[model samples]
Target: MSRLTQAVVLLLFGGAILRASLTDLYLRYVKEGLRPFLIAAGVLLIAAALATLWYSLREGETPDDHHEHDAPASGAPGDDDGHGQGHHEPRVGWLLILPVLGLLLVAPPALGSFAAGQAGSVSAAPASDSDYPPLPPGDPAPVGLLDYASRALFDDGKSLTGRNLRLTGFITPASDGSPMLARIVLTCCAADGRPIKVGMTGKVPLEVPADAWVEVTGVYSPHRAKDPVNDVDVAYVEVTSWQEVPEPKQPYS
Candidate 1:
């Protein structure tokens, strides 16, 4: 650990992975095709922490080339016998600088609505071919809370019946607090995120905020419900316009 604290913990973990992959904060924890492999692993860990701090400052300016290639070890420069050249490292490697100072000071937002209220169901993916393909002419059209919850739960809403669509997510209240419409789907990162939700039902928008970020406008409402933490089926929409936006810059999906 002490190669100058492993080159200052690999240059603060490669400058917090090159300041979160040089910016949209690495889409809040990966995906966006993993930003060029996280900028080539933060430029090869800051070029191996600057070639391990230039070979630990050229072995501290060659102290007589470590007494002409090691041998005279007797314990003096901070010693505990492990041939100390001022040793003592394992203080748990300074807890790896607390996740590189929480990824260089506080980078932690995405995965909202408390991870979709601690998820149990709603990660959508079923509808393979119960016959889809229709709503794209755009009156509202945008769609995609996992393709409107797999076409409202396996095509029962048949390509979202009278369309209107438009969805953008984040707001996961339900369980009587209503207002669902989530989104989080990342298959690889954000530790395998999940969320997808949907449920808004006609004119719903109880003043947003469960991770805000909205943009509703809706119509596909076969009104299904179950999912009391995994009974599954949950899709409805009927919203007819909502607003509050901003969070996107790849907040997953």
Candidate 2:
């Protein structure tokens, strides 16, 4: 392709990278699904830029070469001194200023609570089929601590209505005047995450201070009546075991 075409391609690819890096949707969804496409676009852009640079440096009969008002061959057009070298305008290195400014001074912020409001409620609705194994009808059931927390906050304690779960996450203090609750994040997967409030009812260890990570095996039970989503009766779980552990990345469920 022509130098202009190559430059256009570079600009297009660079724009894609810039936009994706800045947008929230790209961070949340497109980051994973379109990774390969981004990589390919990067390679194509580099190749196009290099090809354009080579073309610019080569002795070429472009439209600019066919100018009527010229000097010599080596000088300008016709007035060749045989030793004179043609003078071309310098490449504008400052064209990269915009991208550099964006990278160095305007780094994107993390997806904050503002996003949670618009991202729509996460669906923890019961599976239509019996995909999940049936929980025992006994007093306590097996469940993840995070799962119970999500249910209590959003599903009205319905998540733990008849099941028990085992979950683990770091500890964070409840804000002043807030209910007695602990927060944990389930990140990239449900494993690494951001902290969401978990209502704490049963005895918590005194040794486990704020920010101390822990693995809590527990039985799901109702706690409060504040259901953020549907006003379903919310609840906390009975903590069976709590042991401190190191924090993991990808915090937030």
Tens-digit per-residue lDDT, 7-45, candidate 2: 555655555564554443234323244555655666666
lDDT of 2 at 19: 58
RMSD of each: 13.6, 10.0
* Candidate 1 error regions (>4 Å): 15-25, 30-48, 60-90, 97-112, 115-137, 143-163, 175-179, 183-199, 202-249
For all candidates in order, the CA lDDT equals 0.78, 0.48
The per-candidate count of clashes, in order, stands at 0, 37
Error of 2 at 211 (Å): 6.2
lDDT of 1 at 203: 90
